[model samples]
Target: MAENGFQGALTYIYDPAILLRLTSFQAEYKNGVTPLNPGETLKLRPLCLEDYDKGYLQLLSQLTSVGDVTREQFEDRFNKMKACDDTYYVTVIEDTTSKQVIGSATLVKEQKFIHRSTARARVEDVVVNDSYRGKQLGKVLVDVLVSLGRELGCYKVSLECKDHNVKFYTIFGFEAGKGQNYMQIRFFD
Candidate 1:
């Protein structure tokens, strides 16, 4: 349990299996996973109150191509997240040295409404600035968030991207559910 610690914090014990897995990951780096092209002065750190608007908005603007999220909408969502009860909230990436909001990732879990109780985490708002896209920052951000979701007992970590993003998610082992229904209500006035 202590094997996977919070970002920037050291875990207590040396779990051999975890260590071996990490070693194997690094050794097989270029085989399948998105290769981490060197980023400009970036660091993966926990989001802060200061990021609620600055870094958060910067990342949200990059979603212009995705055509669903907007800066104002992101702020509203961020406000809602701040006030939700049972929400696992955190922005798990940052670019400190460059002072740029290069990329970000978040996880939200909802309780099941059935007789059986379970929590399902949905990863959302994975964005990387235009300058950072080809560098594979999105994959790294999602990878970290998925790890957090599993650690917190999430039944599954699911996310949705545009149809054009199929190949990107495919490389990370995500598949369309065989018979799942997807519906959405855009806030149109």
Candidate 2:
């Protein structure tokens, strides 16, 4: 029997040995995973801690117009991502020779109670470096994410894009305004 703390919940400390074993297992799993590539030239892999710098570069390519992110803020977000990899599947495309992360996309799965507990995949932050555009890299990224959605047993996948890019995403079987407009309440300045 465990006593409740101030918040009316029990505080249980996990075994260090068990935690270490789990960490070791996760490391083994990560090592066996392969990088994905749509073409022979560029390769894609899940975002890792070592990608902090290059990942920032890829993000700046798309978000420079919106605002600037400080290194501390970026690292804080990265730390949270490290803990939430099960829900957030962010992939980066790399230049094979130079080993540069030239493109990035995120496929986040939202587990819901509706549809018999089916998950919904939201594809976000799809950006290709300016120098790497016009080579159908975006298509490759989206295709890979869609495949990942299926692999994760998601009921459906969706994304929001600019009106001009509606036709672009349509090629990926994404219909514009699928009976619902995207609504958001932003609290950021």
Candidate 3:
């Protein structure tokens, strides 16, 4: 049984060894596109329950405010997301040597009625640990998710980033929509 007591739940959510089966890493990691520092051992894979104790929330704190989220609360949310198969793809990069989640990004696929019922994807919560910056981890995360969106057959993948970060995303072919505005009404601070 898995840690969550749900038999084979981890495999059901995502193949724990997905990285071993991916061929894109061959090209993505070529020419030091996102090369790691000397002696650094990192593995990119899907999020799992064990990540709660592996600094997953701490990694997010480097990006924004992550309030007092307890283990139960975290597990509840993880289970909910896991339950929604084919919808949430929360990928993480872990430092195998330290067993810490150093980076993460989410790709959410939304089913639609238009365009012959094609789906669209939204990229969210992209972040890398402050200490791990400049190692090209952010580029790897974005590239993986964007390629995942294409592999999943999403009509388009979109994300919102601060003005200063716009240039970084452009490298991945993301462009600002002309005459389009991003508006949001916050319900809480």
Candidate topping lDDT: 3
Q: In candidate 1, what residue range of length 10 has the lowest lDDT sum? A: 19-28
Candidate 1 lDDT, tens digit per residue, 1-189?
Answer: 233433324221111122123211111133244322224456555454445444566567666443455656755665666567556445444565756667766677788765357788887887788766666677766665566566656678788888898776665566888898789998852
Worst 10 residues of 2 by lDDT: 20-29
Residue-by-residue lDDT tens digits, candidate 2, 2-99: 22111123111111121112111101112233224345666655654555555545455574454566667766776786566457777767676766
Q: Which prediction has more favorable TM-score, 1 or 3?
A: 3
Clash list (residue pairs), candidate 3: none
Q: Give Cα distance to truth, residue 123, candidate 3, Å.
A: 1.2
Q: Compute the lDDT of residue 188 as modeled in candidate 2.
A: 72
Where in model 2 is the C-alpha error above 4 Å? Answer: 1-35, 39-41, 64-73
Residue 155 alpha-carbon offset, candidate 2, angstroms:
0.6
Residue 28's C-alpha lDDT in candidate 1?
19
What is the Å distance of residue 188 in model 3 from its true position? 0.8
Looking at model 2, residue 66 earns an lDDT score of 41
lDDT of 3 at 186: 89
Q: Model 1: what TM-score?
A: 0.66
Please write out the lDDT profile of model 3 over residues 81-107, one tens digit for every residue. Answer: 888878888888888889898999888
